[model samples]
Target chain A: MNSSHLSLGDSEIRIRMLSQVYSASYLTRKKEREEKSKLLEQLYVHDVYDRIASDFEEQQYQPWPKVKDFLLGLESGSLVADVGCGNGHYLNVNPNISVIGVDRSFNLLRAAESRVPGVNCRADCVALPFRDNQFDAVLFIGVMHHLVSSERQVKALLELSRILRPGGTILLYTWAYEQQKRKFNGQDLLVPRYPSVGEDNPHCNCHRPTTKSSGDQLLTLPNQSQLSVLDKLERIFVRPFNLFINLFKLNSHGDSIETGESKDYINSVPSTQSDTLDDKSINLITKCSNSIYSNTLSHSDYHYDSMILVPKEFRVREFPASSLFSVSKVLNGKVSVHKRDCVSHSTNPARSRDDRFYHVFKRGELENLIKSSKSNLVVSKCYYTSGYWCATITKNTL
Target chain B: MKILTHNMLTSNIIKSVKDGYPLKIAATEVQEVDVDFNPEFIQRLLAKLNWSVICEAITQLDATKDIELPENLTDEVKEDEDMLRKIHHVLLEVEVIEGKLICPETGREFPINKGIPNMLLNDEEV
Candidate 1:
C-alpha cells in the first residue's frame, strides 16, 4: 500500500472520529462554566456581606482578645495593615502603631472610617493596593475563611506575604471546623439570617408571622414547655439512641478517644448552648419518625415549622476544614481536620441548619499555609483562643 | 495613599499585567502630615525599601526637595538620625490625596481618591 493511503488506515480513522466527537469546544465550555461558578460564588459572598453589614458590624464590636494581643505586640510606630478590617475595631486597638484598614464592603469601610478617619480603604483582600514589603505587621483575622475557594485562599496568603516585609509579623484568625464548642455539616453552608422583630414583623415580638398552625409553631419552639407529650416521649427514646450512635462512632474510629474527650467536654459545659444531645435526639426523632411514629404524626409537619424563622434570602458559605489538606498537601503534618459536632444538633435553632459556609481551620492551618507558600514566614506562636484558631507568624530574614 | 505605600504597590496583580511595578504617579493633590518621628522604625523599614524606586517615585511627585535619601544604605547611614528622619518623612508623611497609578506594563490606571487607592480589578483582568 502507498504510504499516504496506509496513514489513513482504520486506527487513524477511528482516532480522528473520536477527536471530532470530543473537541476544543467541549473543553472551552467546561472552562467557561468553572469561571461562571467562581464569579457567582464571589457575588454571593459580596451580596451577603453587604446585606448583613449593619448587623455584622454590631456583632463585631469587640476584637478578639488574642488578636488585640497580637496588635499590641507590634513595635510602636510600626506600619500595620488589617485585611478584612470589619468595622475597624482592631484598627483602633493601638494608637501607637499606624494601621491602614482594608475591607471589601464599603459600608464596613465607612464604619471603620468613622472610628479612624483616613485610615480605612475599600479593597479586596486578594488585591491590596499597598506596595510590596510595605507593612511591618499584617492582620488576616477571621478573613481567610471568607475566600470560598482554596485557590483564592492561597492567593490571598501569597498576596499578604508579598506586602509584608521580611521579619515582619503576621497575625491570622479563622473559625475552626474542629472547635470543641460547635458542630457543622459540610464546610460550605448557607447560614440563615434571622431578622429582628422590628425589621421583619413590626407589630409582633416574633420575627416570623403567625399565619401557620399554632400546633406547628408550638413544636418548633425551642422551649421545653411548648413540647407536646408526644415530643417528650420521643425525646426519651431518642436520647438513648443518640448515645448508642455515639458509642458506635467511638468503636469505629481509631481517634474515638479524642472524640470521647470532646464529648465529655461538651457534657460538662452547663450552658443551654451545651445541650447538643437534645439537638441530636430531636434530629434522630425527625429522621426515624416513619418507623417509630408512623401513625402518631406526619413527618412533613415536623420539618415545616422548624425552619420558619430562617430567612430564605440570606445564605453564607461554610468551607470544610479538611479541604485545606487537599489544597496544600505540604500542610498535612501540621493540621488535622476534626469533626467536633454535627450541624443538625446545634442548640441554637438558628444555627441548626448550618446555613453559613465555614472553612474551619485546624489548629495550625495558618502556619501550614505559610510554610506551603514557601514564604519566609515562621510561626512564632500558634494557639486556639476565643473559639478561633489564631497564629502569629513572623517573616523570616533569610 | 502615601508615596511610601505607592512605592510598594504594583498593578501587576492581574494575570495580564507582567511587570506592574513602578507605577507612574499622577498626583493632583499631595499633603504632608506630621507623624511621630521614630528613627528606629525608619531604620528597620529602610532595609526592606527599594531605594532606587523610592528615589524615582520622589522625582515623579516633584517632592525630591522635601525628602532627600541616599541611593544605598551604609552602616553610617543607618546611624544617621538626620537621614532616618528624612526617610521617615518620605515614607509616612507624604500622602497622595488624589492621583492615578498607571501600570507600567498594562497601562492600567488605578485611581486614588481621598488617599484611598482602589486596586480592585475587573473580572477579566483578574
Candidate 2:
C-alpha cells in the first residue's frame, strides 16, 4: 500500500477521480488482509490529518470559486462522495459540506473514518457493490486517473452515474494530457495530477476570496484549468472536501486514530489490490519503482536483502542484469510513507530510495507522449510532461 | 473464447498509444469453448478482475437471472464451484472466437477468429 502525496490542487483532481472506488483489500484472503491492516494502522488519517493540518497550518486551502459555486448551488443538504478522501483533509480545511469518504487505502480510511467519524469507508473502486441511484452527488478530488484505461475509467464513471441521483455532478482531477508524468510512492504509471512533478512554484503564498467572503490569505494556486478540472469532477464523484465543511468535522486535539492500541484489524482486513508486495514483489517493485535508486544501493539491491510477509510473506532478493551494466542486482529499494515512516531496521541493505526518484523523461520526451495520445475527438490540454491526457470517450464519438 | 474478454484485454506493450492492450479483439470468429469449471481458480480470478467490466461482459452473453453473487459463505459459494466455474467459463474459458476490441479512446481495432485475436496494427500504430 503506497501513500504517495499528490499536489494539493491535483489532490482535488485525483480524489474526485476515485472517491467512488474502494481499496483492493476487500478481495483478498483473511490472513493476508489482517497483516496489511497492521501496517496501515500506522498511517491512519487521524495521524496524517493532524500532521497536514499542522504542517500546512500556516496556509489553508480555500475552496476554488468554480467548485464553491457548484456546491453552493446544490440543494443545501445533499449526499456527496469524497473519493480518496485522506483524513477528511478537504472537509476540515474547508467549510459547510458533507461527504462520504471512499478510499482504497485502509490506513487512509481509518483516519477518514476517525476524523469524520460515522462516515463509511469501503475498499476497491473497480467493482463497487452499491445499488443504483444511491447518491445525490459524486465528487472526486485527486484520485480518478489511476484507473489506467478508458474502458475501466468509463465503467467506473458509469458506475458513479448509476449511483447518482440524475443531474448530480461527478467531480474529477485527473492528469491532464499535457501535465507532467506522475508517480505513486515511486512507481511510474503515466498518471495525471501526480505530486509536484515539474512545478516551478511550490507556493506563491498569496490570498484570494472564496465566493462567500474575502480576506483569506492562501497559497496562490496552480492554473485555472487545474481548478476547473476539480469543478468538473464533482459531476463524477464526491464534492470537494472544502465544499462541505460540516460533513468532515475533525477531532484536531490529537485524539489517537486507533481506539486505544488495538491491532485487531492487523490480521483480517483486505488490502487494496496493489501489486503483491512480498520481498520479491518489493524487490520487483523497486526495479520498476523508479530508476534513480540504481546508483547508491547497487550492492544492497542484490543480496537476499530483506523479507516482507504481512500482505503475505515474500522474500526480497537481488535481481541480476548484465556485466557491462555496473549495476548487478536490478532491484533494491524500500516502500515508504512520506519517508517519515522509516524502515532502516530491516536486515535488508537497500535503504529507502525516495530522493533518487526523478522525472522519467525530460520535458521533450513527456511532451511526445501527450502529442502522440492525442486524437480528433479528444481535446487534451497538457501542462508539464508530454504524456497523453486520458479521458473516457462516449460511444457516439468513438 | 467469447468476444467479451477480448474487448477488455490489451497487450502489455507499455509504449506506443495505451490503446493496444491485451490486444483489441475484432469479430467474425466467436466460439464457445467447453472447459471444466474450477471454482477455486474462478474465485481467485474474480479476486483479480475489473469486476464491473466483467459483469457487464457476462450480461452481454446470457442476461439470465441477476448475477448470482453469494449472500454469504454458503456451500453454494464455497464447495459447489459451479458459481466460480461459470465465472471461469465467462472470463478465461471464453475467447474472442471472433471480432476486435476497439479502444474507446482510439479507433484502433484488433480482429479475431478461431479464438486468436489479430491485434497486429500497421507500422504506424507502433
Clashes of each: 22, 100
Encode model 2's per-residue lDDT on A1-398: one tens digit a residue: 34455555776656544432322222232234233322222232223333333323234333333334555655533555665554455433322334555555445444544444434343334333334444555655444434422223334555555555554555543432121112222111211111222233322111110111111111112123433433443332222111211222223322111221122112212223231122233223334533543322111111110111111112221111111121212222432222211222122222111111111221122122222223221222222211212222111122
| Candidate 1 lDDT by residue in tens digits, B1-126 | 666666567776778877588889888888877878877767766665677887788887865455666777788988998887877777777877778889988889888777666777787787
By DockQ thresholds, what CAPRI class is model 1? acceptable
**Top model by DockQ, which number?**
1
Cα error of candidate 2 at position B64, Å:
42
lDDT of 1 by residue, A148-231 (tens): 544466568877888898888888877643433233333443333343313322222111111122111111212232134225
The C-alpha RMSD in Å for every predicted model, in order, reads 14.9, 26.2
DockQ of the candidate models in sequence: 0.32, 0.01
Model 2: CAPRI class = incorrect
Q: Which residue ranges in model 1 land beyond 4 Å of their true spot? A: A1-37, A50-60, A75-80, A92-100, A110-123, A128-137, A162-169, A179-182, A192-357, A362-382, A392-398, B62-86
Model 2 chain A: lowest-lDDT 10 consecutive positions? A208-217
Per-residue lDDT of A93 in model 1: 84
